[model samples]
Target: MLDYLVFIGTGVYLIMQTLGGDKVRGLTIELVRFTLAYSFLWGAIEKFMQPDLFYHLLEEHSYLAMGMDWEFFVRAAGFVEFCCAWHIFSGRAAGYAGIGLMAFFVIAAVIPFGMIDFIGHFLFIIPLIAVLFTPRKVPLCRTACGTTLAFLVALALYLLVAYAAWYMLYFYLHLDLFH
Candidate 1:
């Protein structure tokens, strides 16, 4: 949904980096971060919501899923994506998480789905790199109770955001595609 924003933000970021527009560069990076976080969170929601779809997909196409437990794998994948999303949002340990996420995207999505997945995920690559390398300017507090509360609140709020985004896309695309 926000693929364009990621692409444009990344371009502006690179340009600003070389041209000395510090504020513009920072803003673009933030834009990339927010979009990537949203994308990862949405993907996690899908994994959590429909394990059967993912399971059948892997079983049908992936040789790796031949002997492994599909159910456990799906849940674990969802949890990993959720963690990646949260780290991206919190801007804490994002580099660590982002690298894992990029690998996951390549191994899980692009490799299995091929060209379609590659095209869909192309914009994500740069944004993930942005979050991976650029530390947050105003970092979120990890020690404070209020900061913890705020982060939790943001997580809860994202549920509604996800729902709203779903409904917004419902009319434009086939809902059965996600199923």
Candidate 2:
């Protein structure tokens, strides 16, 4: 199944990174960073577009309920996620963003959705952990201009890939995402 492939592929990727040499480790870390950025960006956009899903979840399950203004909480959360994704993508305090997101997930898993959400999001924790452990170095582009160009290119590529994946899931597979 596709789910099994994802799990196995992730495990294999992590294992490769763990046993890899220094260059391999660096590449893998960058890969993980890009992946986290892409995922968070997509998630933030989805939350902003379809806030009712998160609003309902927070109202029904979250311990820190927002009561009548639940939509505010949803939008706030989406904004934070968007900011974190930007930070990660731009190589600006990316590790801090990863750590913050990790903490948020820990709280969410404990205070709201419990084991099911925890298990479902367990794979997400891996990249965050990797980002936390990875050293903060200059991005592949050394100069300011180069860095800006690289960031723009990376963002564009990530958005395109994410959109393609979404299209495949929604149109081809007929998966009812976020429902």
Candidate 3:
């Protein structure tokens, strides 16, 4: 059920991002942006409001011992997440920001939680690659390192934006793969 929901969400987001026509794309982008931004913003607010929640989670998982002040890091992460969401909707630096955020998430998952959540984050690299490789602008010369870098960055962004799709594929669409 959750997987299905995430699939739907990812599908909607991709369609919205790739949709043509300025008016339609603008509206769709706005809608997607608002939703994405609000999600992270709310989460940031929540974490700020309830500082102990993260602390308790850390303790429960034995990730870190008691009395570590991670509130600043948590707040900064929330701000960055919110910014990444904003960038995606704006279609400006979104591609780069999205990819960077995904990488950050992957690192965070592996270093803190071990390999448990790593699988989930690792699967996001696929859609990201697709999005990155999709030609956005015409190139004067294809050999430019800048172009390749752009593609890589875009791939990263795609991974971040389409992460729900990965989750859906792993958790719901095809359970056997993960198993």
Candidate 4:
């Protein structure tokens, strides 16, 4: 799927950043961070928008919700995701977000949906590795305006592509967006 391909692109960018990428390191890092933040933002919003869908999935598959009520589990999952997304966007706890979210996707989506879920949601794992391997000396941003522009652009792109993918699923593929 197109979303999975974006992972490949992200991986390539990550690789470039790892290997003497002084050409655009600041911009690249900012873009990667913002893209990831916006991606998680979309994820949290989707869950909040359709809690019943996740609740039913948890009810059916029961991914170690720790004996919690399904409704509470859904809300907690959304809140966790929302908070993590904010923290990552704010650069407060990106490493923790990467680790926690990678585990969450595996436990919540991949375990229930099988290979398709892995294919669709495995991108978060890359961030797990990225945060672990990031160089300590982060490059200083060239300008506040440039950083802001990248954040806005990443948000727009993430929103547009996500909705476009949802549209294809809802229309051409005859799949429910939140069912």
Candidate 5:
């Protein structure tokens, strides 16, 4: 589900970027940022909520398996993901956030899932690279009140869209997402 969203989002971003216009470039950057941010946010929430899934993955799948508790590692990774998502979403040090996310994904792909994971996540690499190369601009919200409001609105939208997507996949399409 998340992979579909990121793939579609990256395609749209690439099309917009290829159009060759200033407004298109700006819009592409913003949209890519939103897509990446939402992806990371959803992943972080899922990891935190279902630590057992991560624990099992670490136990059975991961190559560079940690010696410490799996639950603790899951929580720590979730926290880091949340921080990167927040920074990217808020347009505060977004370039750095993009770099961080890219690094994390690269490491995760190599360490656990290998070439398959890297290929699966190739679409995401474009948007992360775009964000890293793009210049940082002022956030949509300037003032404190506006920033707070924007964050709330973004969170609400993220939840709504995520739920709708999940519902469509699980209920309408009869796909088992958690398996």
Candidate 6:
């Protein structure tokens, strides 16, 4: 329902922006960048503000071991997310930042299990597609195209592997919900 709408809306927006190449495209790009910044900044803040909650979230995630010391990783992840968020909001190299963050997210999606993992994968779609369809300040060349293709290929592979891992872990482990 909502997902379908998002898919269609993004697709149409990308096509129009990519082809039209106008002020509207620039605005769209800025919007995407700001959105990422807000999202990541909030996520980083939340992770530290509620350590207990995050720890509980990790426990439910299944892929991460129960006793693993997550203090440093959580803080580090928060900082990295904040940096990425700042880069995005500033509208400096948004495409490159989006691509880098999207790749990082694709990796993170495969790291955990359950619906959260799937959500992470689906979340990357918007940024990745944004990078692909947005008109860049610098004209894209053949080498850039090849690089994009390679990243997409890697993303797909990671997705397949993640799904399989989730399925296997879901059946083997009885994950308890906190709320």
TM-score of each: 0.67, 0.64, 0.45, 0.58, 0.70, 0.51
lDDT for predicted candidate 5 compared with the true structure: 0.69
Report lDDT (Cα) of residue 16, candidate 5: 79
Worst 10 residues of 5 by lDDT: 61-70
Ranking by TM-score: 5, 1, 2, 4, 6, 3
Tens-place lDDT digits, model 5, residues 18-130: 77667787777777877877777788767755678877777675654456666777888876776677666676554485467656765567655678777767766766777
Q: What is the lDDT of residue 98 in candidate 5?
A: 49
lDDT of each: 0.69, 0.64, 0.51, 0.61, 0.69, 0.56
After the best TM-score superposition of candidate 4, give how far the Cα of residue 10 lies from its true spot, in angstroms.
Answer: 2.0
Question: What tens digits encode model 6's per-residue C-alpha lDDT throughout 1-88?
Answer: 3322334445556776888778577766655544544555556665555456667767676345345568866766666665555444
Put down candidate 3 lDDT per residue, 19-90, tens digits, no spaces. Answer: 655556545434444444344444544454456787777666644433445776556655566555444433
As for candidate 5, its clashing pairs are none
Clashes per candidate (backbone, < 3 Å): 0, 0, 3, 0, 0, 0
Off by over 4 Å in 2: 1-9, 18-23, 62-68, 140-179
Better of 3 and 4 by lDDT: 4
**Candidate 4 error regions (>4 Å):** 1-21, 93-98, 107-109, 135-179
Candidate 3 TM-score versus the reference: 0.45
The residue pairs found clashing in candidate 2 are: none
Per-residue CA lDDT of model 1 for 1-179, tens digit only, reads 54335556566667777887765767767777776776676677777666788977886776655567888777777767766776776776654665576557655767667888787776776566657788897766665575567657866776677667767788569867676
Model 5 deviation from native, Cα RMSD in Å: 4.8
lDDT of 4 at 62: 82
How well is each residue in 67-94 modelled by candidate 4, as lDDT tens digits? 8987777777766765565445555335
lDDT of 6 at 21: 78
Judge candidate 6 against the unseen true structure and give its global Cα lDDT, from 0 to 1.
0.56
Candidate 3 Cα lDDT to native: 0.51
Regions of model 6 farther than 4 Å from truth? 1-23, 60-68, 91-98, 114-116, 132-179
